[model samples]
Target: MEPAANVLDLNQLRRSCSSCALYELCLPAGIGVDDLDRLDATVKDKRALDRGDMLYREGDPFEALYVVRSGALKTFVQNEAGDVQILGFHLPGEILGFDALATNLHVSQAEALERSSICELPYAKLQQVTSEVPALHRQLMRVISREVVEEHRHLVMMGRQQAQEQLASFLRSLADRYQRLHRDGSALNLPMSRYDIANYLGLVVETVSRLFSRMEEMGVLQVNRKSVRILRPELLAALCRSDAAPRRKDAG
Candidate 1:
């Protein structure tokens, strides 16, 4: 006898949660098919953005959460003087816009650092589905908790006085995130500009440039514009923990 006609269709599966690359990271483990279907229904089609495109500006009404489907985005806030402070850089497979959940108004602007695409989940629809899906509700809570933990970590990183340690930590964190995506941790293609990075790290652009050059000289990393290759992971890790400032050969 031939296989049943009710067999699964590859094309149909590709359009659902089963084929999403972020399925494991974005959804609950061992979720039932019915729950997955309901959750999937909340996700709108992927929306594309160009470099410098603003996804949502500060004070925009909170209506949806976005999952980075490709490329990168940066969230930032500008003071009255119009000086922009970058809050964070987002990568593919990561969810963003959680900051607005508390006040129902965005506190920062989200802009595409490069050409990007994202999947939007309307907050109302997401709530409706998640309420009916216990596992999904639990997963959403876990995601929110993880975001809080990461924000705290960023605050701690910013408090470190040494620029060397700050830069090192930033690189290490990026590498770790890449590793989690099952990609090459040693290599990174940064989507944000040096200015944005300096702003986010609370360092001057000149300082960030000098640090990158110094790290390259030390064989800790190789940098070419936005592309970086971490040559010595151990050395980078050491820098993250080191309290001493980088020494210059001309200091003698």
Candidate 2:
């Protein structure tokens, strides 16, 4: 007869990165179990957070790379007058702390949008591990490069894409992210509210809502409360690529 499994203190058990759902997405492809074990050793704990709990604050000294294990998070920046601007929504399989990598100081704050858990990878330890595993070094560079490319894409979106087109692209992006995390892409769970979406998209809340309604009416997208479904993903995708090329405005 088998004994009952220990249920208490499961969080303290040795975590296997190979068992993680995001293993394929975040970690290097085709790495063996030994590599996975070594990578797992770099992460210390899976920290749980409540909604609105801060992962890190602006000006906090950078220490480790944070990977979203579950739920969602948002990064924001504050102006001199203390007004906050939503920067981006981060999902599982995504890494935070890239913005702080160069300066060793965070210029923005990351907060949980819902009940969340994250794996902590200490930077110094990661650097040492990378020396032992060259694949990880390349994987790290690829992850950082994706962030840079996304930022440049956003600059282009805000500069050239029309309001409706921008909203469509944003919805598509959310769908893609959720899909990549092994979630249902047809329907979305928007943890952040419309105001946060508007703030990120450079649009007002009313405009953002109106655009969603317009897209639904056009049979391109559908929204039910916080759940959005792309009715015609192909058409929506077309709209995203149909935007005019960004043009530089001359300072008069």
Q: Which one is best on TM-score?
A: 1
Show where candidate 1 strays beyond 4 Å.
1-15, 244-252
Worst 10 residues of 2 by lDDT: 243-252
Best by lDDT: 1
- For each candidate, what is the lDDT? 0.87, 0.83
**Tens digits of per-residue lDDT for model 2, 30-136:** 88778777888899878999999999999999999999989999999998999888878899989999889879999899999999989999999999988888888
Off by over 4 Å in 2: 1-14, 242-252
Q: Report the Cα lDDT for residue 20, model 1.
A: 79
RMSD per prediction, one decimal?
3.3, 4.7
Q: What's the residue-level lDDT of 131 in candidate 2? A: 88
CA error at residue 237 for candidate 1, angstroms? 0.4
Which lDDT value does model 2 have at 4?
48
